[model samples]
Target: MWLSRACLRLLIGSDVSEHEEAPLIWLIAGEPSGDLIGARLIEALNQQTGTRFRIAGIGGEAMASAGLKSYFPIADIAVMGLIEVIPKIPRIKRRMRETIAQIREDKPAMVVSIDVPGFCYDVWKGLRGSEIPLIHYVAPTVWAWRPDRAKKFAQELDHLMTLLPFEPPYFERVGLDCAFVGHPVLEGGADKGEGQRFREQYGIPPEDNAICVLPGSRSGELKRLGEVFRQAATTVAEKYPDAVFVFPTVSYLRVQVTELTKNWPGRTVVISSISEKFDAMQACDVAMAASGTVSLELAMARVPHIVAYRMNAFTVQIVKLLHGWNQNFVNLVNILLGREVVPEFIQEKCRGDLIGAYICKLLEDPATCEEQMRSVDSALAMLYPPNGLPSDAAASFVVALLGAQNQTNFDKR
Candidate 1:
């Protein structure tokens, strides 16, 4: 029976056998941002090795375009927040179990989990005893909100790949093996010209000083802050009649933002593409944005901006109860710099009038805008290594770890 099964497997040409020469890297990315990062890493891995590696797991269209074969629909797992995920727990668990079963049966060389801590951590836990090396891309916000999760993550992952420079030190302090991959944004050049062209393309007057408003990509976020953002823009328009408002809308939320801001009198443009987003950011004199990765992108673009965030009342209250930290993550970076380089407004303080007032101040005062831009330059300089070797350095680290493990196995044989 065993011989017959082996012969049948050989005759059928198993999918696993095709990948015998190169390692099978199982990549799981749970959001659009993570999917983009995973695609870049996939390209880097292929370039570094000069051999085609088989990538299989869950990722969206971007990763699929980069040669990743999905085990299940990636969008199914793209969930957020504790309260939002409760209804989908059973479905998520089923997916996790299926993933673990595949790992055990096929035995991939490495499991690379990117972002989505809640789901990926469960997958890691299920496959804890497997020989497969675990690599987690984009360290969780353990540094900020929950430091204790660091030790648990350290125990599970063989290596943690970080996008931020400050992340490695924090993970290392908790005894995790980690590497800082300079942000992908830096790898893509920052062109101020793109910003100007975007304004022109969007029919925004070149003479007008535009302020970009990015509420967030999520529907819930738009619903929460859309009215406030529109009101803020109206106030700014009143202060500076020449000021135009630009919104680099995520494709998914375009309709929502449009519906919300229909009554506003100011000229507003919503751009969806990556190129357009970069251009919009550059074209704007200042930005009023939600506190998220977009803020980092704006900073990298050298745009002076104000950051704000609004969450469910229940969630905010619970967070306040559990964490005694006075400031949210938006202002935390500025606080680390020892000055208010980027002003932050949150909760009730994130009113339209106040945000509008602050933005008006920044736009009118060239000195203030320059000061903020200087701080952005300083922050980016500190974040990246001297030679701009973040992508190459990170890829080398992952390849070396895999090589070392293979060598150890051969030695044992």
Candidate 2:
């Protein structure tokens, strides 16, 4: 009995030592949404176990707030698209090279590359020879368009953590380790019954119809879509004189949007912050938004919306060649329904008059809005994860993989 007790103590001590030996995680979140996910994961990991793992790398405000010491300014690395990146390619390449070199010097146990595949893929390629275990968050939409990129992604990362439930099977078929982390927005809870409150708070008249306009957070996006959005609002207002237009202004582009929409005839209101975004989405009868994650948010709010976006002719052409679909946003409803539940107007098609016409129809016809909402609900039903916080599930998977690697190293040593 004494010998058995001693053996148990020794085993427990070894486990403690193994826990202590857990490698510091280096996280790279290339954009705002990715940074938000990274931040939540960091917080969840800290709470899950008393493990003292140090976090460092490139990310935005959310990651910074969660105690990540960003090596490079995240704003500097926030370039998007193929043609758009050409001008800043040299600067991006230099920053990426520096980041890789720093990672080599630091020799982290693992690297977590968040979204922004254009930059993150390059980072992955640079570090491939270093034998560092990498976990990529938010698998790129190879399934949606570039099915060939799956093979390349399989070769690059040790594991791929996905936000959508449908993504794992596609990666798994290609022999890549992937796990669905559920949608972060779902984990954060839906804004229920807040629509009426939102309208009241914003002083939106209950009798008046409302149209929410989401131009986009990026300056380039706003620049390209602003005039079109304003024009669309004008068209809608002309059709429905009692309609109010609410623009959810992201912090950086508030001034620009205000200056651009100054002379608009309709009652235009620009709001900032997350609560305000939800309030605006809830209060509005219909939404005309840029093609991005915001479409998903509107869907979750059960708001009928039209997704519209415009870019430079070169960028549009390049995307057209690469991607099978010409849709601007990846709305779950659109994907599940296999038809546009929320109509998507891209590039040349994304005009003010067309958008105004669409909004007017959605508002005027109750059946159109109802049919779209039903499709959205069906799509939302498909997005559930098995258990726990999405971030927790992702972190747990990483922790388990790290443990296995540590055990293998210990055995070899």
Candidate 3:
């Protein structure tokens, strides 16, 4: 909150200097998904003010492409849940220390973190009571589970930028200044892909059942989901011999995903780049994806899809402890819809055959596919902000500290 006037006064005088350089912002993204968000936010920050930003922190290729000089590889903090994170605790702590030290030394204008709350919030907690105004993009899914974290996080955060329209209230109720800046998926260019071009490039027949396969971006995700998805794809191929499977994965994991799916009994294409990923999404008739952000992208693209996820047995138990035995939906589309608009197979029900059956149903039944699209359209409508792109809304929210304050701009957009 102090960053509003005091921090701005430190950089730009009250009259605003024409030649002064913009403030240095420290940004941290701990996964591929977060890397995308950070990259878009960086673009927004620079474009909204027509001033370049001095950036520092950690991210993957997307953020790097957007002019971020990452402190370390994004993979360093990609581990999830109790089972995956236990072995990397030492490395995580080391990285966190390095991050905190770098932030303190830089004395950046603001510290904004994208998702990856485990690492991002930890870094922020270390800087609590300091002058740096903390703004976190993409509110944690306390609404999904762990609702108590909403109040706990309010104590340390200066502001929170949420993607979901319903998320700001969770933190606002606890006394934190929170804003719903819209979902980045709205401006991610998912809906503009050329399906014909993608089909031509891959020589996929227009009549063939093309399925976009997203096994997730993290190493642990690829390891857990690869086998299950392969068997599932094989099942679909057995039923629809002309079906084509499109596997879109992170660049680092592309080769591994291709190798894993090589023997699946269909025409398989693995795509690495984001452009190709969106093109594949357009070309595909349906999708079988890991339970995460891609599910939201598929919904935005209006593709019929079923989501499936399998976590470490120990991690599954930990989630059960935190989430209780009632709510089971992990995919954001289903979670946002307040019902299973998309079929979900998670944990114990995450069998290859079961997922394959759902994929087959989505592929063959036009009614089922059309029905899902209708629901997807309804869900997508709620994600748009009042004006401009979601990132633009986020940009306006972020730069309010640098200029005259506008109370209506906080959440009205």
Candidate 4:
């Protein structure tokens, strides 16, 4: 996706040397998943405009690779859970100030903020009255919890770009300019894996007994599920001695995962590369994963999987108080399906014995595996939007906005 001066000439109808300044846009992504989406969006913008944008914001490795120099590490504000965020509040506030300061100094045409609503909301408030259009990618799940955020978001953000097909209506009902960009995973996200090659490279036997374990990307997730996942793997190994257990994680969390599995009682392997992680998902017979984006990935991969999630007790209480006990499914797949397409063990129910038994049944019984995978396939079918690629759609919106801004400036001149 390298940009050339020739392409720039064709796009802008002028030589790069003759141009005084390129359009600048600020993008902030507070999580690794958001970083991936932001990087893809940046690439889409570059491909559409022939590298006319100067990107500056907060993001991780992927956005950095996409040519954005983040003002600070995204990890500074990546914390989840109510109690977990308390200690980081001061630092988060400081970074928000620093980010607003940079935005004021740069005066970019627009600012796009990816998820992490708490941080992004504060940034929006900081930028209030500046007249910089603040566009938010990945709308909050108000249907699940904090439904009031939708109304507040309509007031704060100028535009909302959602990954889910059903999300636009919720924001639109509250008078927000919303677009349903297809989920990023649906657009060429499933072709990254080489399943057979991954099995051979990792010495995993080509059999129907391999399982993938994903504990999640958060430090709190590892702390909560580490031992339980290890014990579950042990149980699976006991039931099927030939069973292979694979765990894939990001590099930042590799050391924590490795330390968690150092004394594992069964045969297990932890892989850290992005390609290997996707390959493992494709290669596995069934996946036992934390309830998040990986569940959506497994659905996209058509891999049979079960999910589990646990949060701090205080945070759980807060959720119950805010959203109430009527909320059921935690996994995105199940929530989208409106049924238990995949079994979920959450909070106190997130136990190794129960999750292992379910895994064992799926591994031994082909019918069970087939049934679960079919449900996943059905739910995945609902995520596709009318547009072809979400990044392309999002980039088109940004480009049009930038062009309008240029026109306004020329008219003023």
Q: lDDT tens string, model 2, 252-280? A: 78898888779775788887776567777
Alpha carbon lDDT at 386, candidate 4: 65
Q: Give the residue spans of candidate 4 off by over 4 A.
A: 1-20, 79-88, 187-191, 262-265, 312-314, 404-413
Residue 216 lDDT in model 1?
Answer: 81
lDDT for model 2, on a 0 to 1 scale?
0.79
lDDT against the true structure, each candidate = 0.75, 0.79, 0.81, 0.82
The alpha-carbon lDDT assigned to residue 299 of candidate 3 equals 80
- The 10-residue segment of model 1 with minimum total lDDT is 1-10
Clashing pairs in 1: 195-279
- Highest TM-score: give the candidate number: 1
Model 3 scores a C-alpha lDDT of 0.81
TM-score for every candidate vs. truth?
0.88, 0.86, 0.84, 0.87
Decreasing lDDT order of the candidates: 4, 3, 2, 1
Candidate achieving higher TM-score, 1 or 3? 1
Q: What is the lDDT of residue 205 in candidate 2?
A: 86
Better of 1 and 2 by lDDT: 2
Clashing pairs in 3: none
lDDT of 3 by residue, 308-374 (tens): 8887889768877977544556767666788889888888888889999889888768999898889
lDDT against true structure, model 1? 0.75
Error of 4 at 342 (Å): 1.2
Task: Please provide, for model 4 over 149-266, each residue's C-alpha lDDT reduced to its tens digit, 9 standing for 90 to 100.
Answer: 8999999888898988789999999999998777877764664677888888878888647888898888888888877777787888887888877888999898888888778766
